[model samples]
Target: MQRFTVTLVWVCFTLATFPAQAEELALTSTRTLAASCAACHGPNGNSLGSTPTLAALNQQYFIQRMQGFKDGSVSSTVMHHHAKGLTTEEVTAMAAYFAQQPRQTPQPLPHQSFLGAQ
Candidate 1:
């Protein structure tokens, strides 16, 4: 009887921690996926040029645009390919991550030339 009670307590404790573990794993995966966007979107979704900024965007809007891109309803030079590769859950997670970031103007890169002059 005592062994049974102890086992039950252990099982309950393990189950209680499972959700937290899962949540952490999901966040990590989302962050890893989002890191790829930095190539053009800039760090934390702040665009360095004409590309649209992703930080602080409305979550639903982000999701909708991504879905559109995935479905080929939204036109893009490259986004359709990228969007089509992501799972819906990944898109939702990335949207949430970007929405929570604070937007910042990106600084020009060192040695950047302007107006055809250095």
Candidate 2:
């Protein structure tokens, strides 16, 4: 009876940790996915140029814009192609991730040239 009680307790304890593990895994996956946007959107979605910042954006708005891009409703020079490649789940995850980030102004790059002229 004691052995059975010990096993039950161990099983319960193990099961109790599964949700935390799953949450951690989800967060890691989301972060990995969000990292891909850093190239154009700047780190944590703070844009450094003319590109619109994604940080602290409304989640639903983000999802809608991405969906619009995917469906050809939004015109873009590059976003449509990028948006088309993302699954709905990926878009949602990215939206949620961006929404949670605090928005910050990006500093201008040193010695930046305009119109390709030095």
Q: What TM-score against the true fold does each predicted structure earn?
A: 0.80, 0.85
Candidate 2: what lDDT?
0.93
The lDDT per prediction is 0.92, 0.93
Top candidate by lDDT: 2
Backbone clashes in model 1: 0
Q: Model 2, range 1-118, lDDT digits (tens) per residue?
A: 9999999999999899999999999999999999889999998999888888999999999999999999988888899999999899999999999999999977777774577655
Error of 2 at 67 (Å): 0.3
Looking at model 1, which ten-residue stretch has the lowest summed lDDT? Answer: 109-118
Pairs of colliding residues, candidate 2 = none
For 53-85, candidate 1 gives per-residue lDDT tens digits of: 999999999999999999989999989989999
